[model samples]
Target chain A: MIIGALGPEGSYSEKAVQIWILRHRLDSVGIQYFADIEDAFLAVIQKKSDLSIVPIENSIEGSVGVTLDLLHENGVEIVGEIVVKIEHCLLSKGGPEKIKVILSHPQGLAQCRHFLKKYFPEAELRSTGSTSHAARLAGEFEEMAAIASPEAAECYRLKVLLPNIQDRKQNYTRFIALRAAGKNTAEQVFEQVLCDTEEKTNRPENSSHSAFKTSIIVYLEKDRPGALYEILGAFAKNKINLTRIESRPSKKELGDYHFYIDFEGHISDAIIKETLKDIKTKTDTLKILGSYPAFKA
Target chain B: MIIGALGPEGSYSEKAVQIWILRHRLDSVGIQYFADIEDAFLAVIQKKSDLSIVPIENSIEGSVGVTLDLLHENGVEIVGEIVVKIEHCLLSKGGPEKIKVILSHPQGLAQCRHFLKKYFPEAELRSTGSTSHAARLAGEFEEMAAIASPEAAECYRLKVLLPNIQDRKQNYTRFIALRAAGKNTAEQVFEQVLCDTEEKTNRPENSSHSAFKTSIIVYLEKDRPGALYEILGAFAKNKINLTRIESRPSKKELGDYHFYIDFEGHISDAIIKETLKDIKTKTDTLKILGSYPAFKA
Candidate 1:
């Protein structure tokens, strides 16, 4: 089996995949690395990989816009989820006193703004493509330091100068495992994997008591005062608890938007089905992304 | 008067301020540039500038998370808004063929991904703090190109290699002018500015016919199935049109969020006040970020 994820081998996406692998106790899996989230997602869509793991949202930085946009534009189903705790570290080849420049992804630098301002006030900051990429580059220069995960420090053979340097301590990133839609064999395999994990963790066998989440996108036909309110009313009337709600630009106009909503229920549930049917009537377009077991970290 | 905006002089935020100045025919206004959005916002909070202009949302990129988070954290009020059309251009010290590297802010590079892939497929893409900064760096290297505004090309003494290179032509950035809350004198001055523009545009004298937008942030006391639905219900019940609604991480947990909402009525409107009063009862925290005249274009 081949799994695709954003890479240089030490990305947080890779960490999510590792957790998924450990949960399922999978073996004989090959990992494919893509430079960007969209490329990784497309690998699954094009059948280049059986599944893809990509970051959906970060606790501090908010949603990954490209990932959300790709999910909306492509025909893919989210089969699993993994929540990885983010702990940014400062890595370098030499001591902190030797560092004159810091390198990182824009988000890494932004998340550790306070730490950098206080400690390395005079150091120049440069942006890179990824945290792991910064780690790789930091390995070549003694005057350079990187803000990345500890895994990246190990992969690049760099020393951890400081740990947990992010501005907020409760940072996390949620990743989703995606597979091509209408793949029955893959669906069966995923279900078996879930069942094995449930048995190992001693979770309840009843489907009604299991934690599951369904995601969908809604676009209104026209701009009205209460259009979104009415659409959301469908979920409210069904007593479905929403886990997340976000709006993305529709690309046609400034004020126009398409909403992505996540709620607590499986699509197979009768109430969930009815709620979606009612929402469809109120919206111009409604695309069901998928239903998956909720991550319990 | 002094205005604070994100800048190296030719940024989109500067363009928004220029448009605001032109609309009001205001002179003797000096602009103070800050390296980041937070600094510009702080300048207003600290009374270092009379007003601060910052980008709140983009037609293609969605909301600026830092700007939204700061508004929710700080006590500043949005007194005005400006909409600036984004037209990205390829700037270089020499011809396009001489370009080996392309520099831009991350959003600029992402927005023009397709154009670069098709034309300059092998050029190395580098990220900078701002588009204007990229233009400045490009001016020093003949082999470097920048994805920035035409104004940046002129400011940096570079030639425009190509115009309108962004993937989307309808791109626009919306900027908000902020002031310290409870500054009644500034509020009156802003109202007079709006009235002058309205008369110049031959708009109706009736305040009821004027287009204004109110922004607010809501944090639910707890996560429940119908909590948000009830808050939004207030607007729907009052028949107030929502211009935008977005969720930002509250920075407490992965699932916890704060909703930023914009609607079609001013805070002083009787119906709007009643709707807010009802919403206040439904949520633990509701902050009014002030109301301003909506940008016409």
Candidate 2:
């Protein structure tokens, strides 16, 4: 199976996918990467890749809308999830005073906006594709500095001007693993068994399949008032507690939106099946995007 | 007052602020423009400019976290909001077949991702500072296409490959006007008049002040379970009807978040004020970000 990630081979998506491969003991010879989240999603859509890892949200930056919208428009399903800590560092080719500009992804640039404001207030901040690319550019130009990862600074041969410069101390990203429209039963069962075995080694008191969560995206009929309420009524009736729900524009019809909902139970649960049936009865479209182990479970 | 906007003169934010200035009849000489959202925010924070305008959310792209977080950290109040339609065009310095790459601001790039996927599937997509910057780059280079505004295409003398290629039919941006901590009575009175005029223009039959919404950002003390519940309980008691709520990491402390909420009432209402008091009693901090006329109202 081919694996795709967002990268020049060192983005957070790359790291998340690599960690998933290592944990799953999957082969990586046919693995590839793209520079943008949409590219990674399209790779899955076109059957160029079996699975793609893209960031859906970050603790510091909130929602990554591009990923959210692509999942809304396409037939890809989010079969699993992974959380990676975001560690941002300030890198420069020379001392801080020598830097006239700072470069990083717009998200990275925003994550460190406080540090940038407090210190390099006069530097012209710029946006690039990824943190590693920013660090690479900083290494190539004496007047440039980068807000990136420490690993990226070393890889790009740039010195760390300031370490751990993210505005928040505990920033984490929630990335979803996208696969073609159906489930891989063998992979799913194998992952569950592995998780169970791993839990046996050092199980936390809260560890169980019950703790796992599932996310699904649905689109309602046009300008339907109480439409969300009707769809949500199913979950409420089934006692399937919803953890979160957010809306993204459908893009197919003006003002129509896809509702992304997260509930506390897996899709295999009987209650979930009943709830989805009820939702389909009330909504114009219902797409089961994925059933995944939610973050920190 | 010194006003800052995004520009080298003509761009979305520049046009947005200009519309605002014309609507309010403010002076052009008092206005200064920056190359990016952060720069505009900084202009206000550093007292280089007394106020600024930045795009905070788009119908297709959702939240512009850079602007949101910058203002959140810098302690600037969103004095007002303006919704501007986003019309994107594809410009080129080469023929369609010769164009090897497409460049744009990340948001603009994401907005047109569907177009790229369907048409120029093989083109390498790159992101730059702004749409106008991409147009300028296209003017200086060969074999490149830029996803930008028609104004940008005209300004840079680039060929328009396609016009209005955005995925959403009605792509609108919600731009927030910022000022320092305190309120100016004259500006407030003027804004009230403007707000009333806006309501009169857009008021549909069966519309009320409670028809569309109210937005607020709340922060709670750390290590409190059901803190959000208690705060939300106030609204539940009044049946105020919450439309949306989003949580972003509060840079002040690790593992803490500030919840931004949209409910359905003005702060001037008695129940809303009582709700605020109840929420204040239950939470560490509560900042009413703004209670302006909700978009599309």
Candidate 3:
């Protein structure tokens, strides 16, 4: 089995895959690294990988728009979710006093703005493709430091100058495991993982009763005053709790948008099905991304 | 008057400021440049600049999360808006054949990804602080090309190797003009601009009935099925049209969110005021971020 993920190896997406592997006790999984989230998602669609793990949202940074956009554009189903705690560390070859430049992914740098502003105001900040990429580049320059995970510091053989340097301490990232639509390999793996989880937690075998999340995208036909309100009313009337709601531009114009909503229910549930049926009547287009067991942590 | 904006002088934020100045026919406007959006926003709050202009949303890229977060965090109000059409150009000191590195802001690079992939697949892509910064760097190196505005190419003395190189042609960016709350100078200027607009368009002088947009931030008191729906219901019940609705993380946990909403009608309208009063009762906190005339273009 091959899992596609954003890489060069030490990314948080890889961490999510490790957790998924450990929970399922899977040992034969091969990891394929893609430079960007879209490529990783496309790998699953193209049948090069059985599943793909990509970051969907960060607690501090908000939603990954590209990932959300891809979910709307592609024919993929989310089979599982993983929540990884983000702890950004400042890594360097030498001490902080010698640093002339700071490097990281734009998000890593943005999350630690206060720390950088106060500690190394003179250092030039540079953006790399990924946090791990920043760590690798930091390894070659004694006067450079990187804001990345501790795992990245170890992988690049750099000293941890500062741990948990992000402005907020409650930083976490939610990643989704995606598979090509209509593919059963990932579905079987997800069921096995859920079975293991149920056994460990001593929960019931009925999958419908478990905590599941269903995601869908909706586009309104007209720019009416209450169009979105009426569409959301279906979920409200069904008493379904929404975990997330975000609007992405439809690309037709500035004001036009497509909403991506996540609610706490399985698509197979009778009430969920009925609610979706009602929502479909109110919306011009509605696409169900998937229904998956909610992450416990 | 002094305006704070993101710059090395040729950023899109600067272009927005130029358009605003042209529309208002202001002659004594001076621009103060900041390295990041937060700093530019802070400049207004600190009274270093009379007003600050920052990109709020893009047609293709969606909302600027940091700017929205700042609106929620700071005591600034949106007094005006400007929309700038984006036309990315490939610039270089030498011809395209000599280009080995393509540099631009991350958004610029992402916007022109398809163009670069088909034309210069082997060239290294680098991210700079701004597109103008990339143009300036390209001016110093023959092997470097930049994706920036045509104005940037002229400013940096670089040849425009290709124009309109972005993947999407209908790209537009919405920039908000912000001023410190309780400061009447910006409000007075806004009224002057509105009067000028009414004169040019041959419209009536009733400010309350004009095309206006009001922005607000809402935080639900509890995680319930109908919490957001109820808040949005207030607007729907009043027949107010929402232009945009986006959720940003509250930075407390993964699922916790604060919704930023933009809707038609000014805060001064009787119906709008009543609706907000009703919404305030439904949510834990509701902050009014001011009402401004909607961008016409």
Candidate 4:
């Protein structure tokens, strides 16, 4: 089996796929790297990989707009969700004091902000394309340090100058494994790779845990008063729980937005269908991104 | 009079303040450049700048999360709003054939995505801290080009190789002028700088345009089903229109978010006051982020 992710081999996206592979016990998968999330997502559409893993959002960095936008644009389904805790390490060739420059991806730079300011206040900060790339650069420079995962640091053979320096230790990023809309990637994973996750399916046949989440993209016909309120009222009257809600520009006009909303329960449920039907009447468009088992934060 | 904005002299934030100053007819204002939004926001708190212009959102880039976060953290009031159209220019010392590298801020690179792919696909794209900084670098390097504002290109004396290359021509960014809360800077501006803004004020004595907008920060007591729906219901029932709604993490933990919502109507209205009273009951905490007249998009 093959999987697609963002990389030059040591990226956090690569790390996320590694974690997902390990969790599913799919140890024999090949990893293909892409330049960006859209490229990785495109790999799935192009059938280069059976599935692709890309970050949807970070707890600290907010939503990964590219991923959200790609999912909105393409006919892809989020089959699986994984939350990876982001741990930033200070890596260098020598001691921390020897570092005069700190390099990292913007998020990496932001996550370890407090630790960097207190220890490397005088160091020049540079935002690189990826933490692994920063690690590779830091490994070649004697006066440079990197803020990245220990995995990326090890890949570049750099010493860990400091471990877990993220401002808030609970910082995590949510990644979604996406595949072509019609493919049942989740069924394949549960039946062949991992049976425990099967405990999570809300297929009505699954006997174990049954927590499912449905994601929807909503577009109202007009910017009228109570337009969004009426839409929310549909879900509220039905007692559905919303996990997340965000507005993104429709890219059509200045004030137009498509609300990306996630809520509890599978789309197959009667109430969920009723909610969508009502929302359709009130909206210009409604897209069901997918329904997948909910993952713990 | 003095104004604060994010800058090193040629930044877009500086351009925003300049436009605000020009529109308000406050020609004698001194512009103080700050390292970041917090520094500029802090300037207002410290009474260093009577007003600070900071970006709130962009048409394509979405929300400026840092500015949103700082506004949430500080006791700041948004006194005025401005929308700046982003026009990206291809700048270089030599012609397009001589350029092998492209430099710009991430947003600048993203805005002109199509133009770069078509014209400079072979150029190595480097993300700089700001478009002005990119212009400065492009000016010094004969083999590099930059995507930045025309003003910044002129500042560095770089040639405009191409103009208005953004993927979308209607791209704009919204900036808000902030001051310390409880101090109606608009009232003072009307008395001293700009009287028209005062006429638009919600103050009971004001006899001009009454259209107003109110922004609020809401933190739900718990992640209960329909908590947000109930809050939205309050406004919907009152016929208030929401201009924007975005959720940012509270920085305390994952899954905890503070919803920053902007809606039409003045807080001084009895209906607006009643809506807040209802929201207060449904929320763990509520903060009024202050309001100014709605700016045309």
Candidate 5:
């Protein structure tokens, strides 16, 4: 399998993908890099990669807007999710004392600002494509160091000038793995079959039940009062608890927002599917991003 | 008045403050530098600077969460706002062709990612504290360049490797000048005048009409259904229009938010004041942040 991620070696996206790849021992998977998340999605849409890893949210930063924006515009299904605990490190080309300058992504730098100020108070802070790229650049320059992930140091062969350099110890990133539509990619690792064959046969002969959570994006028919209330009423009427609902301004029109909603239950569930059918009639557009078992953070 | 901004040069924040300073040129005003916006605010809170200038929002990036968070926490109050149009330039230590690396703030770098891919496809992209800081470091080294404001090149004594390097021409930032909560201490360059003085005098002496906007932060008495709605209804009953309302998770308690609100007029106006008093009765706590003329962005 080919996996595409935001890269030029050590971005948070790259680090996230690397950690997941390592944990899953998917070593044979071909990995490709893109300059941005949109490009990474295009790589998947154009069939350049079988699966792609994109950061969905950071504990400190909240949501990755670009990732959500692309998910809205592109057609892809979230098959799996990886929540990796992030520990940003300060890396250098040579020894810690030899480091004259530091480089990292803005968020990475922000996360480690307190550390950088305390330790490298006199050193200049620089921004690189990603923490990984910064690590690689640090390795090439005699006076440079990087603020990035430990995975970055391993990738670029740099020494860890400082460890656990981030301001927060609970730094975590949630990444989503995307595969082609209609693919049943949910792992049995976290799933428990709720059906007993004998009991199932005693009921409806072909009946089946599986616990699932659904994700959907809806564009309002127009910008008007009570539009959101009407859209939300569907889930409320069906007694389906909404886990999350966020609004992103629709690119097609100013002041119009596309709402991304996540709720318990599968799209195939009788009540959910019925509510969705009514919701489709009320909304300008409705697209299901996925219906996978919820991953507990 | 001594104004502290993120500097060592021409950065978006620096240019933003410079534009406001030169235009206002408060009598006997001076400028100082801080590592970042948070430090700039700290300068005022710690009595190190009389005033501080910091970016609160960007056209594309929405709100600067850090700035908003600072405003919510610091004892400082926003006195004024200025909108500065952003123009990004590509600079190099040697020359454009000699530029093997490009450095800038992540937001700046993200805005110009398309341009980078189109032109300097092979040049490495880097991040920094600010565009000004990037220019400062790029000037000290050769082969490395920076994407920063044109003023950055002049301030750092570096040449503009390339002009108009940003992908879009409409990048702009809205900056707010903050000072410790006290009666105007430095000078009265600008005063919070009524938006419409005619309406104030024309109304009966006891009339409740107001011509200024007031901002307030409130904490809920308890987490329960209809609490926010009941609080907001106080204004609605008085025909007061709520211009903006947002909730930020109050880190102190789980599932509780501190609501930031902006209403049509000042607390001095009887109707608005009465509405706030009524809200105060229902809310656990309410603090008026400021009452100023509504800013047009």
Candidate 6:
């Protein structure tokens, strides 16, 4: 089995994959790393990997907009989720006091802003393509340090001069594992997928997977005074709870948008099916991304 | 009078200010440049500048999350708006064939992806803090080029090797001019504010000024099944058209969020006032960012 994720080997995406591996105890898995979220997602589409892991949202920064956009652009279905606590370590070849520059991914740098200002106010801050890329560069310069994953420090042979330097300790990132959408997808083979998950966790098969959530995208046929209200009413009338709702520009006009929404309930449920039926009547386009068990439990 | 914007003198924020200046015909205003959006906004809050202009949203990129978060962090009221079309120019000292690296702000590079893939498939793409910053560096290297505003090309003394290189011709950015919130702000002195916008556009003062839009951020007391539905009900029942609605993390937890909403009608309107009253009852927190005229003619 080959699993794809965003790379240079030390990304939090890789960490999420590791967490999944431990849960499933997969021994025959090979890891493939891609340059970006889209590329990682494409690995599944292109048949290079059986599954792809993607960082979906962050507790501090917000949704990874590009990841959301790519999910919409591709025909991938999310099958599983791994929520990882994000911990950035200030790494260096020498003492922290000797470091003249700090390199990291932009988000990493933003997460450590308070720490950086309080400690290395004069150090030059630079952004790299990935945190591990920064880690690799940090190893080459004695006066440089990096904010990255501990896995990256190990891979780059750099010491963790300081640990968990993020401004917020509770910061977490949600990564979803995706596979190509089609006949063998989650809905069609729900029982088999549960069996696979059951083998990993050593849990009972009949533990009530009632917290399944469905993802969908809706586009309005025309701009009206209460177009969105009419759509949301469908869910509200059925007592369906929405977990998330975000609007992205359709790129055709300023006011027009495509709404990405996640609501509680599996698509197989009668109420959810009815709600989607009503949504379809009011929307110009409706795409059911997938139904997956919520990570909350 | 002074206007603050993010700049090395040629950013899109700077261009947004120039558009506002032309529309208002402000001749005596000095332009102040800051390293980032926070600093530019801080200039107004710290009383170093009377007002600051910020890029609030882009047609292609969606809302500027940092700008939205900063507004919530500070006591700034959006007093006016300026919408400027974004046009990227491929700037370089040498021919396109000689360019080996393309540098730009991430958004700039994304906007010109089609152009880059077509013309410079092999050129390495790099991200910068700002497009103008990339242009400044591009000017120093003959083998490097940047995608920046035409104004940036002028400031950096680089040739516009290609014009209008943005993938979308309709790409535009909406900028809002902000001032300190208080009795002296637009709300307390609504008449004077309209007079100001009216004089700048050479229009009669009494078109009712009904085109005003108000921005607010709301946080639910707790995550409830119909919490957001109840909040949207306030605007829907009142027949207020929501121009934009986005959710950002409250930084407290994963599900908790700050919903930034923009809708038609100012706070001065009777229906909008009633809506806020009812909304406040249902929400744990409500912040009235400000009311401003919509950029629509």
Which DockQ-derived CAPRI band holds candidate 3? Answer: medium
Model 2: per-residue Cα lDDT over B67-144, one tens digit each: 767655666666567788889998987777788878887788777767887897777666565778778878887788
- Per-candidate TM equals 0.91, 0.76, 0.91, 0.89, 0.74, 0.89
Q: Which residue pairs in candidate 3 collide?
A: none
Better model by DockQ: candidate 1 vs candidate 6:
1
Angstrom error of the Cα, residue A182, model 6: value is 1.7
Q: Which stretches of candidate 4 lie over 4 Å from their true place?
A: A94-101, A113-126, A183-204, A207-210, B97-101, B113-127, B182-210
Model 5 ranges with Cα > 4 A deviation: A6-39, A93-95, A140-142, A151-161, A180-265, A269-288, B18-26, B91-95, B136-142, B150-165, B182-289
How many pairs of residues collide in each model? 0, 0, 0, 0, 7, 0
Candidate 4 clash pair list? none
Which candidate comes out best when scored by DockQ?
3
Give, for candidate 3 chain A, the lowest lDDT window spanning 10 residues: A195-204
Q: Please give the DockQ score of every candidate, comma-separated.
A: 0.62, 0.23, 0.63, 0.51, 0.18, 0.52
Residues B26-125, model 3: lDDT tens digits:
9989999887777888898899899999888888878887798889888888888999999999999998889998888777777786787689877867
By summed lDDT, the worst window of 10 consecutive residues in model 3 chain B runs over: B195-204
For each candidate in turn, the interface RMSD (Å) is 1.5, 4.9, 1.5, 2.0, 5.1, 2.0
Model 2 has an lDDT value of 0.70
State the TM-score of the second chain for every model. Answer: 0.88, 0.81, 0.89, 0.85, 0.76, 0.88
Candidates 1 and 5 compared: the better one by lDDT is: 1
Per-candidate Cα lDDT values, in order, are 0.83, 0.70, 0.82, 0.77, 0.68, 0.79
